[model samples]
Target: MTESKDVNAGSTASKERVAQFNQRFDFGSYAETRQFLDELAELSKRDDYYPDVSFGKTYANISIDGEGQAALREMNSTFIADMQALVTKTKN
Candidate 1:
């Protein structure tokens, strides 16, 4: 089975939520946000888990994942901790 599978079995029991994120980073005004998005994109690339991205004046709904969300919490908690560490903002 793929390491990407069934991870939710070991994750949080929170109901699925639509969220947004904004934050401060190690650079200019919105640099952290950009870095957050860039790193998220990079992580998605590595795991073949791309999400939708929408840019706006003050925020971006940079999807962290898609339909396969049942296991997202698990993936981030375990297999993709590196990716989890990079995201410092979330909206719900």
Candidate 2:
């Protein structure tokens, strides 16, 4: 798994204890990117958790956010695990 940094650390929003995780992934093609996004959507739907997602032709940027202590831990762990799995699968 790649190390993810807190992109929101210095922002004013961080004062509220809002946590965000950001990661970028590359896909072989646009079709693969779309497929990955669809998979992410399915997983998010199952977990009832959604992230702010954006993608271009062959790359995707995913950001997950949470606002409270417990929520932050849960959201970050789940998102990291799921995203790591997705990244591994797509790379193979």
Best by TM-score: 2
Q: Report residue 3 deviation for candidate 1 (angstroms).
A: 30
Q: How does model 1 fare in lDDT?
A: 0.49
lDDT of each: 0.49, 0.71
TM agreement with the true structure for every prediction = 0.42, 0.68
Misplaced by over 4 Å in model 1 are: 1-28, 63-66, 70-84, 89-92
**Which has the greatest lDDT?**
2
TM-score of 1: 0.42
For all candidates, the clash counts are: 2, 0
Off by over 4 Å in 2: 1-19, 68-77
Model 1 C-alpha lDDT per residue in residues 1-91, reported as the tens digit of each score: 1123467834523433433222222333366656667777777777666555655444555434323454556465332455446654422
Per-residue lDDT for 1-92 in model 2, tens only? 13235785366354445555678999999988988898888877776666778889999998765442345376554655776798778778
- The TM-score measured for candidate 2 stands at 0.68
